[model samples]
Target: MDEDSSERRWEDMELDILVRIFKTFNIIELTSGISRVCSTWRLACSEPMLWKTLDLGLLKSNYIKIPAAPYVWVSDSSDKRLMRLLKVALGLSRGTITCLIFHYDLYLKDEHLIYTAERCPRLKQLVLPAWNQITKGGICKAIRIWQDLESMTMPSIVHPPYIMEEIGKSCKNFTELKLMGPCDVLFASTLATWLPKLKVLSLRCTVLTKEALILILDSMMHLEVLNISHCVLREVPEPPAPKRVLLELDETIIGKASRLREFYTCLEDSCLMSQRTKADEGLIRWYKYEEWLWRMDEVSSLSVAMEQHVEVGGGGSIVPS
Candidate 1:
């Protein structure tokens, strides 16, 4: 190397130039070591622009299936590791985070949710696909904290009224929702009652009843976009009769949905996603199928982006800036 080039130090670079360079690094790379190089680099790492969207889509919990209520036993080491990572990320973010994304397999506990809620006061969007360990109270508390929340992607719960009520009361700006499980009549009714003004909804790859679909279309007057792609639409019958699966939407449904700006549906037998949904009996067994399919959504805003993986030392622990 030339003497002049060797004499120049990275620390002498302008902060704006360093921040622009850091912007290209992924979450793992940013939290791994670049910040520790110098005080100036550390300042660049803490810049609000770099922390606005904290996407932990690649991080998943280490757990084993159990035959109990929770159905999975997450190791203490795994929980601690997640907590440590959250501490480092949230600490550097300094309450500037607006969007947060989590992997569908990353089962988070109440403490983790609460810790994140307390830090990300300005959070506007969240995509948390797994909620096996999260309790109703824990979710309500988080909702209360995230009053500015506008969009979410979550799994369906057993009883939906309580959470819907909480969201209605707290997140006035909330308009978009994506469900990763069946949407029964009760769930649809609860949404109509609480979030009637919801603008965008995605019930992709789930069981959706004909009555529920109609109710949503009729009730959500302000709905602008709806996605029922790859859904197993069914009609429940009276006593002594079995539910019948629907192959196509009748004129009634088509006419009502025509008013929406964007309505997505795929029920063709040749469609791979539709076949998968039927084979899995409405609830998709994501682990048994293609990984990308589970994260794909008809609504572009709800789709998960493909991220690059990077290997680091210290058992992959995320180091703070």
Candidate 2:
């Protein structure tokens, strides 16, 4: 009876404390190390709340570099390991995953995504930077299953209409979107038509067209936040130059967007950190500077600067446009 009393007393410790301790673990240690220590630890590890935000960012450490490629590729061994880790993480999640972030270097296959989608039906926010191998059909199938999805950060695909349409139809709460590539006229128009209720949009460090910018500002009535920092705007020449010119957002656009809770334009030309040159296009890989890329101030900044319309103050707070 004494031994039974001791075990019960140990188990009586606050569950919140146990969860706090478990949160310190990396994916590998949480899955393969602490989970197997004892039933109590295993139970703690399997807590649904603990698995809500499954950040696979550390998986980048296991990525194998491929020669002559700008992005590193995951090896067969790494893929198998990742699959196992994902299985363990999702199983522990018990279908309660809401936010998932993948590393830029990790190449996810269709099967991997399908497996995740099948389990994480409650997922709301997904950040996937690399989609080199994921086909349209594969992603669409997953998106269809993700009925509750709200926010997503995705790679730039040439054709985004079908995916946008799919999300518009299925995800009623879908609002926030961040595109990591060129937001051209067609893409912007598609978004404006399909996702009229979109609230937050980030087009940072991409090729943004002037027409597309105008369309988004004019059409998306529900927009509350906009980020167009470091974007190379499509030139608006008299006859239209073949090469797109970097643009400065005029007052009209700023005035419209500034009505929102937050509006992020661009930084001054003198600010080396904010100025993105044409040559720098696709040159700075996210993985190389993932820490800086994901910094809270930089990632979530709604600060702005334009020719004279808007400026982001030192503290990243918004000054009047």
Candidate 3:
């Protein structure tokens, strides 16, 4: 390397400044693009502290345009590019990755998940919304490897017992679970049976039966945080008509579950209206509106789903007249 050019590059962007800039870029750019620039950049990207939480969701917005479905037939070229990116990112992480989040549209095969599980042995939290392509064997393999897994936000499956049993047997520290579909009696019973000591459970935006919910609250003795906001909890006859009501936790049930630090429930018609309008307007993309809602209101006890993209006038709701 020429001394004059090297000196100019260093003066333009120092190593410390370069590290800060690289941190802002998503995993795709860091693994596939930035690190390939030079040896120095690659070294910086390999820093363990920077690879703690590997979020690959931004790649859907940047490169891959997946179909609007749970699973898609990824083109050969895109598949190869994805594998290459994962390999590079996991290689850089060096088994220190604690959290791994995949986009809802990013259809992943068994090989992709296995490769990830092998690389990220210390994985604790995983947010995978789409699992249509992943087989039972694939997920079980990953669970066995990720024994330290604590929290997971995933799509609901038809058969819950297998996965619940696998998680209970393998992941001893698994306490937090979030389901993205209907929470029926079967799901609740299976969960209570296998994971009675569960702490945090998020069933946001799902269709849950009040009986099942109450059963969970009554059965899961060590339950702490329960998030059922935005959920459609059974239908009831509200005098004039049969209106779908959220599971109303009266003072008795609430008092019984006093150990719970947070209990999220959605009964606000305004919030539901805003969500329906947004969905109709095609503003909520990537089949992940529920996930976004949960993230926005996980902390607040009484959070209304207010759309921030557009402005509201007089009324508190975001719906327009």
Give the number of the best model, judged by TM-score. Answer: 1
TM-score of each: 0.91, 0.83, 0.78
The best-first sequence of candidates by lDDT reads 1, 2, 3
lDDT value for candidate 3?
A: 0.71
Q: Which of the two, 1 or 3, has more TM-score?
A: 1
Task: Tell me how far candidate 1 lies from the true structure as C-alpha RMSD in angstroms.
Answer: 3.1
Per-residue lDDT over 222-289 for candidate 2, one digit per residue giving the tens place of the 0 to 100 score:
98888877667775555655756654777777777777887776745664435542446623345444
What is the C-alpha lDDT profile of model 1 across 1-321, one tens digit per residue? 866666658988888899899988887667667866888888888999898889877543233333443355667777786787788788878999999987777788999999999999999999988888899999899999999999999998889999889989999999999999999999999999999989999999999999999999999999999999999999987868999999999999999999999999999999999999999899887766654566688899888775654433224444442
Candidate 1, run of 10 with poorest lDDT: 60-69
Superposition TM-score, candidate 3 onto the true structure? 0.78
Q: For candidate 3, lDDT tens digit of each residue in 1-321? A: 866664457324667777887777766567656887888888788888788888765442322343454334555655565677788889888898998877656678889999999999899988886787799999999999999998887777899999999999999999888776778789999999889889888877667777778789889989888987666667444478864654365676567667687876665657863355234331223345543343343634223232222221122221111
Off by over 4 Å in 1: 1-6, 60-71, 310-321
The segments of candidate 3 whose C-alpha lies over 4 angstroms from its true place after superposition are: 1-8, 11-17, 61-73, 235-255, 272-321
* lDDT at 318, model 1: 45
Worst 10 residues of 2 by lDDT: 304-313
